[model samples]
Target: MKTFFQELKNRRVYRVAITYVIAGSATVQVVGTVLPIFHAPDWVQQVFVALVAFGFPVALVLAWCFDLEDGAIKMTCGDGRAVVTSRRVWILAGVGLLVAGSALTGYWLWHPWKRLSDAASMSSDTLSAPPVIEKSIAVLPFENLSDDKQNAYFADGVQDEILTDLAKVADLKVISRTSVMQYKTSAQRNLREIAKALGVAHILEGTVQRAGGRIRVSAQLIDARTDMHLWAERYDRDLADVFGIESELAQQIVSQLKSKLSAREKAAIEQKPTADLAAHDLYIRAKTLIASSALSTPQAESLLEAVHLLNQAVERDPAFARAYYQLAEAHDLLYLQGIDHTPARLAMADGAIQSLARLRPNSGEAHLAFAKHFYWCYHDYDRAREELTLAQKSLPNDPLPFQLAGYIDRRQGRWPESIKNLERAIELDPQNSAFLEQIARSYECLRRYVDAERALDRAIALVPKDAAMRARRAEIELHWHADARPLMSTIQAIIAKDSREGKNIAELWLYGLLCERDFDGALRALAALPIDGCHQETILFPRVWCGGIVARMRGDTASARAAFTSARNELAKLVREQPAYAEALCALGMADAALGHKEDAIREGRRAAELLPVAKDAIVGPLLVQNLALIYAWTGEKDLALEQLSIAAKLPGYLSYGQLRLHPYWDPLRGDPRFEKVVASLAPK
Candidate 1:
């Protein structure tokens, strides 16, 4: 105002105020946008700039419109009356702008919000070691070196004991049997990739050749990163000294790792198993079949055989607690898979625990198995953790407990922690496809497709015969890129496999349609599903997020919004019922972002993050994390979005890496510095 400016000129504060506002706005916009790059999600940085771009002019326009210049000293209208002049108006405007900026700033910092925008680029890194120590070790899976294949159990028993003994040492980071067994036959991938994939420095490989009373065992340790031989040893001994040989080998390996060891660890290595060699061998065979079965049917056959063998072993050596322990694990595995062998499972678990208690006062495997029995079969979390804790004490080197712990942590919604344990499990068993799948799933929850794909790739290679693995790979490729014809063809091949079995295989068609952006084709595929399961393939909470996916491919946000609304409702139902469906929550968050429901998107994405740790290992995790991260960036939660993307980038493997990177949801984050990092992190190893 001329009057206020005239009066304010005398005070000297008016000029300072305008200059300050201009400078401060510029400073906030410039510094705020870039600063978030270090801490905020990639998308959030873009949002920070956008908010400033939007807010400043509006603020300036208001200042001009209200004519509340000169700190509101006076505002005289043309009528020559002060238009309700109040100095508070100046303060109010400043306060309102600050409040708006602060609110947006908070959004820029939301962790879960950022996860939405970066979900697509999520991935699986580098390593360092303690300088004072040179690590060396070897791991050997129990080889089936029996003529009747009946003695296969004995070989497994030998390996298990050796692994257990090596695990007890504090100085060693022993690669668990699971990781080493990944190299059971052929390893096409380079050692570095294998080592990096396994999270282990050295790999131990061995073979067992046994004939009647005689045994020949040979082992060699190679550094995965350098392809250097750390150690090699062979033991030719009577079957009677089998236990002694394993114990001695473990001790020798521990010494070779070049780490410090405690007296307790040394004692643990020497502790004898309560199993007679013959009985233990039989028990090992049972364990082998029990571990191999995936579904309930095969699992049943294996466990039943285990029970029979264990009974014989028990009869042969009445004091064989190891036999009892395996018997317990078999029943527990079956029950957890919802197999109908509950009664047998329970009886066997109880008997094993009881026998183990008498044989050794503290045994982790028994307790861990007991925990699984209670947790999965009886629906008890506390008891499961408790048992796992005891198992941790007894068999610290065993990855099964940690694997189960990861599962438990997930069920509890501890995403970061669950993922950490799952990662540890992978380190223990690098080639275990199931564990790799789990790691992939964790990244997927954060929406890290890049990382997820690496894990998935490893899994696919491990068991090429696994139709499901191929199908999963197809799904990831479908979502990763809209224009990926090759990926679609891969998915189609996966579906064609099921055609022979008379299964619907509709998800393949639907996903293929979505990738092609042919809504009609998708609808046709959806219609072919068994009524209730149709939505299981598409138009469901997460599957429906592909609607937004489809719309984005078509460059039609309106269609995306409509699909998003439907997805939101579906997500709402999931949140209402279980409230722990992180993938569903994540999908909702992404849909919300596409539709411009920024506030709602952030809120929903946060819930998804909360639920991700506890989410089940499913096909949707990568999409969930990637989409949610994209949302956060769009809404201006830069730091959070970046953090989310970082996590997503490490997902074991993503079904759709390329597509998510190119999606419209991440458009807001494009060209951001942190986004570059996300891209780098997501690039293949």
Candidate 2:
């Protein structure tokens, strides 16, 4: 054994092995760092590792069989001799130093956890030890410090751009714009408390000022746990370099937090949305309006304003993909509001979507915009799902994409997946009422009333002043919980707080009265709302339908006939003005049925059903189908009513099983075995 070792040393095989390892490890370290910068595939690193391993044995064999004489390789004989010299030992020592350097480089390149402080790296053995969190952050709404308060939109735009840039970093958990906007003018919560509430390690607060053609931005990063200022900076730049300011701010945040950014993320952070500053400003302003108007008391008018603003933005810079995306979103809101369903509106929305696709082919916002158009406008569930999947890949950090995906899943009867996606969205925007509301609705669909109620309570807490939100919560209580007491008390309290805003809760008041079988109270609530004040088709249709139903329940046949005639006249005019208005046609059909015009009801209902077959998954389609079934039931067509009920039970539209069981419209078919089966199927397993 001693002779074999001597021979190996004499042949320089041991030196060769050490040298090869030192060179190979150094090469691996370099490759690891450089490959990621170039956005190289993961397999490239694997292949490099494999090649290094394969070369190790080849290097040793070459060292044993060949000798370098004047840099020329010549055959050499290995003999048992003490040929180890000090030169070779010193060379080995140098190789040892090289190995250590390579090891240090490899540690720096591959092991990120090593960079964390000992306190942050402590084991979680102690019960009282604080748990280590990832590089998570929340960028609070930037204060508008401009001389002109109207420049508030500009400040918001600046903050949003920074937050968006930071979100591109996968290593950082960025709280979304929706959740952060709650802090826009709020001063009640301390930094530490706000960070804890948002589940972030750091909080970013900033101020923006825009004057004439120049801009100034000041930002600071604070340690949420200790309330320590980690970093702060100020920037003065021309309006044209606004994108640079955002990119620099994002880079500074990443640097302060020691967050790693992938090549794609870096590119995304630096990519400017538009070259036209005016157009970009318009887009940002539109986004701000859209965000504020989402599910607000007067969302329709606000969305229309945003739509007009986005149109100007797109015309200014036809290549503005984000503007086009926002335009599509505005159209989607208009569609969902049932304010307009004209082909011209649909075509304009489609044009916006096409612009998004052309301008930003790989953008998540583009995919999300197209997905919304498909899901809401076209009711193409499969195509919407596919686009959403692509959107998820493109904008993995965005909660909106996941939220939309959840809605699509719910519409397609994929309850578990829907809940999962909605929950994920909540994780990203914990305080967002829109996401919370959708989650509650999804839970209601599964008949998980308790969970649904809990979600609604959270949403109501987030937006207590929102009458529409209050109405929805009251609805959940009335139908799902089969309890009118809570709904009555809640609606009364909301009304007592502010009578003007209380009008918005009239629908819920009517629902509560109906739940208690109090027709007179429902009529009173309907009178308070008054058709003249209710412009939303959703609210208007419901008011007219419930008013007629309440009058019928009270045995006031004349009042019931008058209400039905009014609703029929209004809906008929709407259908004539916009023949594409499927919901209006359905409303007209239901009104006709209520007035005992069975043939007219059938004709109108069939026309609605045939006008938009794709809308069966939308609110209008199932609503039309349900009303058509109501028409069939009123005319003594039990089989058709049960058939429509079964179809509606599976759709996202119409009432809950509890509502179906108690609704007066379905009472005509209540004793039928098929109706019972359909209602029974709605019960959660």
Q: Which lDDT tens digits does candidate 2 get at residues 1-685? A: 5765676777788888888888887898788778766756666676667667666656665676677879888766433344545454445445455654565556447643332222122111111113337688899989998899988878888888898888777788788998888888796659987877677889999888888889999999999899889999999989789889999899999988998888888888889988888888799888888888755555567788899899899889888888999999888777766666667778888888888899888877888888889988877888988888887765767888878888877766676787778777887887788888877766565556666666777788878778778777767755664567777887778777877765667666776677677877777787766443333224247456667778899999998898888778877887888776666777777788888888888888888877765344454456667777888888777788878878878876545765766656577887878888887776543
Summarize candidate 1's per-residue lDDT along 1-685 as a digit string, tens digits. Answer: 6765554444334554566457756766676555545666556555655565456434543443345456763333222433324463465356556655775566457543345334322332201122212463446464565676766556666777887787776556666765566554553546666666555677666667788788888777777767988788999999777777787777777666766667767776777775477677677677666666652222456667777888888788877766777777766665554343235556767777677667755656567667777766554677898889888765766778888888777666576777778766766565678787777766655555566777788788777767556666666654554445655576567656665311334555555565455765555555454322222211134445555555666667787777768767766765575455455566567667767788989988877655544144333344456556778887888777777777767664342355445444466677888887777555433
* Candidate 2 local distance difference test against the native: 0.75
Error of 2 at 55 (Å): 74
Provide TM-scores for the models. 0.56, 0.73
Maximum-TM-score candidate: 2
- Score residue 500 of candidate 1 by CA lDDT: 39
Q: Which candidate number maximizes lDDT?
A: 2
